[model samples]
Target chain A: MVDYFNEDITSLHDKLVRKEISVRQLVEATYDYIDKTEGKVNAFITLNKEAALKQADALDEKGVDPDNLLSGIPLGIKDNIVTKGLKTTAASHILDNFMPVYNATVMDKLDALDTITVGKTNMDEFAMGGSTETSYFGKTHNPWNLDKVPGGSSGGSAAAVAAGEVIAALGTDTGGSIRQPAAFNGIFGIKPTYGRVSRWGLMAFGSSLDQIGVMSRTIKDSALVLNAISGHDEHDGTSAAADVPDFTAALNQDIKGLKIAVPKEYMDEGVDDDVVSAIKAAIATFEKLGATVEEVTLPYTKYAVPAYYIIASSEASSNLQRYDGIRYGFRAKDVNSLKSVYVRSRSEGFGDEVKRRIMLGSFSLSAGYYDAYFKKAAQVRTLVKRDFDQLFEKYDLVLGPTAPTSAFGLGEKITDPVTMYLNDILTIPANLAGIPAASVPAGFSKDGLPIGVQLMAKALDEATIFKAADAFERHTDFHNQVPAFKGGQN
Target chain B: MISKEQVTHVADLARLEFDEAQLNNFTTQLDKIVDFVDQLNEVDTTGIEPTTHVTSAVNVFRDDVPQKGEGRAALLKNVPEERDGLIRVPAIIDKEED
Candidate 1:
């Protein structure tokens, strides 16, 4: 059996090329490990084992390509990415049985490189919640401490990777979904610049804020996947036409004389002391490596959360209008009128958190309240972007804690929506500004939950983010530590 | 502070319905959220131009060439109800009211 805990994409690819392992064997081993571990983690919404094995057999017959690092590597996809014939529910009852007629652009790219898709990971319904508890499929427990959340809406993807069910997973981040969960799971995740990856087939929550990204045990593994998925697409017009670089080439690059900025607002009283200390130590490590670090004021940071919610929800309220029960997805039974079908289906299909966002979004965009809420929030968004733009003038990257605190207990903040929303304060600015940001395992908290330090660079500067993150990974042992939780059935 | 009436009105606009208890609960929660977001009003955005898209790219266009679309069978596969290769929906105009 292939041991995912010790193996990464590059290592597995080498093994396949050398004929030391067959793709079929690797696919079998992945399913075996997932079957053994999934009872406790509850990370997946659907497992594509039968098709994955078939793909593996075909790959084994075609033979492994030596140059392709991702060839035969198994990955867990976030459930929101459309996969033809595979159930792609964004952990919402609305699309519980959704089978896309075609694959997402990212899936098509991965398929071309011969990557095996193990299954679709669970997420918040429509990627709305900070904790995965809002999912219709139930919450995903953190592998580190079973009672704690894995973080959302990419919680399941993070947990699955941390549990060694898959070496790497694809996750989407609107407001900290990918990075926060990666921090909680003690792994690596990177959300590329807003237009770095295509969103043509991703279930839209916030069109302006959402971006697809990668999560893995190592920074290099994520870079390998990012290299394949980063580029322009005719399908998504927002996708940048900028040149895609070989991201893996940035690994182990020197950090001497690199200027780093720490926003004073990020290190304020809102952050937990443990998380702050971990990030402080990380900053010190960069200084030790000959990089200069300074505390800079990004005063507009305080307004980021409010602006992010307003903008994200407004976009979501518009994007989700497509699910009207006439074409596809869950339809309310016994509804006679078309209006009744639309109302009843949406009300019955969506969870509370989704309804809450929709209400807030609709209210904000209403005729009477537009200027006070939506327009004001959009204007605040300009200031937030300016904060990053100003910082990028003096600093090559902005470093801070990915989340204010480590993963909290599953039900601790679910009942309080505002408290949950505030947890994303640090990560939201990156999305608002449309910059590339990443979370790498910095250290563990006093209670043994993982903590991650976020490194953000200017728009389309994912290479620098990767370079700095890889250097940190090389110097730290935090990424090597695996969770100790065994499934109850085990 | 947001009232239950406002929440209900917004829910209707969003094509969602809520029971009395959920409306009461959501009103309280939404009030807290609105109050929290109200802090954004403190910032001075008077001369600022609102950013609609983060990237400067606009009016992205491609060739007008026709491409093969998903066939009717594939498109209708996910439909809850279908007839004559088209999605079936509840009647839009109420005959009794007319």
Candidate 2:
């Protein structure tokens, strides 16, 4: 079997080009690895082994296209992205058996490149929680330490990539969903600037904040996939019309004189000391690499979480109203009235966190509260964006810890919704500003959990983020560390 | 400051129903969350414009063109109840007793 642990997309592509490994061999090896490790990680919601094998066989008959790096490559897709004829649940019971009749824009793009879809990975129900614990299907344990939670709602994607189940995976980030999990799993995950990628067919969470991105073991693999998925799509009005650059070309680029702003609020009280030290050490490494790093202040940082929650939940409440029982998805049994059908179906179908957000959103947007909550939050969002706007005038990037801490124990903060919401405090500002941000493996804690340093760039400047991430990745060995996978035991 | 009655009202608007235990639990949790978000009041936005979206692009229009949708058979595949290619739902109107 092919050694998935050591072989990345480029290496696998080289082998396939030389006819040393057929697509079937690569696909079979991926399933073998998944079969061995899935029970320990619980990273997938549905495994598309049969369809994937059939696609691999077809690719073998046609021969590998040496020009396509993603050709014959096995990739895990986040469950929220609709794949025609494949179960796309978004880890929510309401969508438990959903099978789309059409593919998401990204899936269509991947299909054009001949990338094999391994499966739909798990996530938080409706992408509402900080950890994958809220998934009705069950939580995805961190690959680094199974007893700990994998940061989510992209936890399964991160674990799948980290465990070498697939070459890479797709993850969506609304407020640090992609980056936080990537940090916990010690992988490279980038949440591109809003509108950089099409959102068509992605199950909506916070529509304005959601952007589909790539997660992989190496920065280059992510860049390659990002290249394929980025650019304009008429199907999604939010998609940017700007040209998609060759992100892979940004790899190994020089960063002399690059200005990086380290926000004081990010490292202040509430952030774990070890995570702070790991990020500070990473800042020093950037300085040594001819980049200029300096302390900066985002005065509105404290308000970001509040504003983000209000706005995100408000949007979610509006977006999720489409799940009424009359059309599709789960419907309640023994309902005599349409109102009862709607209420009972939703009450029975949604999980606790989803209901909480819907309630929060409905309350915020309801009569006598819009100005006090939703509108107020929208105005505060302006201030948060202004902070980034001003910083971008002088600094090319903002640096911080991806998450406040690394992979807390399962159920540690699950019961406390306030504490759970605070986990994304450091990462939410970028989403509020609609800027591109990424998490790259920085260092490890005393307990051996991986820490990641976040890099944020001006809107539509993912190339610079990629350049800095690639530079940091090349100078450090953190990304090279693999999890031991001890099966939920310390 | 959020109360159980308020929580129930919001649930009603959201078309969701909760049991007594869930209502009490949610009410307490929502109160805490509301207190947490009240921090936003600390930031004074005297005349700041609300940012509904970050992108500069607005009113993006596509050509007036007709396209095929996923066929009715495919669209109805996931519907909980259907009859004669139509999604079946509970009655919306009442009939007068004859």
Candidate 3:
């Protein structure tokens, strides 16, 4: 039986406040779980035992104060988030040993709340790939089925939560990096509307598309984390100045009369039957709860992926150019000239996936072709956003499958970049429109892999997302299931 | 069609070299991708405005006032070679005498 230790964040905090368990004990239990399960999952890239324990001990010394909502809770960070004096690798060979001199804005917010970060988690090289196979370090396996991949580039964060390694972790979403992986791994993950969370200190990959996200086993816990880490930051110029609602406070609110739009375009031919059934079942549950469900069409939804690719790659080409062996990262030692050093360092440091993206980005942004490809893609992006704008006029939230299919075999789609890119089709539309989207554990496929149902909301309306996601979780038992590790009986 | 020569040229422009096998592989892969992306030509976008950012906001810039600096040493510490506190590199473009 899973112990009370496995309780969600809010309940765990309540227990802490009641003095049922000390903060030190919770921190120790988290580390114990990490030590036990990390061998099988390989979720964390760096686990700073000293720093984590110190933070936990300090929180304990401060005692249970009413002001500390997330005090003493041990958390994991995606490697892309910069933490002072820790290696912020983004799971790339180029930055294997590069240390950050400062913390990301989100980290500072979490720090202010006294949340103890255990360490940085793994990711695809520069958060580039979907399967996590493209990580410079070895791939992170699915907690459910070891042979299958954990979805990525937030694979490590999702896997860690699913494997009970960390209660929660932070992830960054550019093109469904958080939600898709959360869906694949059978956990709750959320990508807030662009600018809802600050982007300072996150290694840039499609700067306009990137938003820091959260992953956890329960929707409420995910929302709690979101509330803690999200807010305006002057450090990040793109951050929104909108006031953050108390996500946990409004989670229990009824969705009795809320109108939901399920885009017909997302239910096209390529979508798997099992995924469709799961979403339909979720819709039925919503209808029973008194929420009105209707079909809405995002006619330009089909154009989202291509448009996302052009814009994201074009931006990435420019963002990644800063890592040309002239700054703090891996540099080729034997090269004689600066040109040779730049070329050789990048050539040797970046993995195949990273190189492919850099090449694609450069190609997309190249002279003469930008108008035909990048500019045209931008126009299509506007159309995609317009479709969402129209849909929001009639609906409270949008719901769909996070991916067309379930978690695939590790190497099945890696060789074909386009096929791999297709895994994020449904989730990318939200990013393209700069809206908030989340993937919650809906149910399992016949093969027992997890299936995810996504809830997306209009810009800066995360309260709606939390309410709907919490409502879904309250009616489902999928999040209760845990993965059996190696040598463990299921 | 993308040739090995074009691949070499692009690679040179990007400041990298690929092995023979990698060149062959990338050429084939890039050719297919370029062709697939060409499908975008079907949609006619005569007067539509290009969207540079998804959100309606514009010119998201932080204040120009300096808050903190990690120092020049940390910034230039990883340069492969430096002379007189400046990064040293081979001349890709020739310098003219005054």
Fill in the DockQ of model 1.
0.84
Candidate 1 residue-wise lDDT, A249-352, digit = tens:
99989999999999898999989999999999999999998899999999988899999999998999998899888788999999889889999999999888
Best-performing candidate as measured by DockQ: 1
Report the C-alpha lDDT of model 2 over A73-106, residue by residue, as the tens digit: 9999999999999999989888888889999999
Docking class of 1: high
User: Which model is ahead, 2 or 3, in terms of TM-score?
Assistant: 2
Q: Write down the DockQ of candidate 3.
A: 0.43
lDDT (CA) per prediction: 0.92, 0.93, 0.84
Clashes of 3: 0
Better of 2 and 3 by lDDT: 2
| Cα lDDT tens digits for candidate 3, A1-490 | 2242368776777777877888778877788877877878889899878878777777778786766668777788999999987778999888888888778989888988888888888888899989888888888888888878898999999998888877789999999999989998999999999999999999999987999989999877888889888888887778888999998876777889999999898878899999999999999999988899999888877678778887888788788878787757888777656677778988988888777767766777777777888998888887888888888988999999999998888789989988888788899998888999999999888788899999999999998988988888888898898875533222
Q: How many Å off is the CA of A406 in candidate 1?
A: 0.6
Rank all candidate structures by their lDDT, best first, as comma-separated numbers: 2, 1, 3
What are the candidates' individual DockQ scores?
Answer: 0.84, 0.72, 0.43
Name the better of 1 and 3 by TM-score.
1
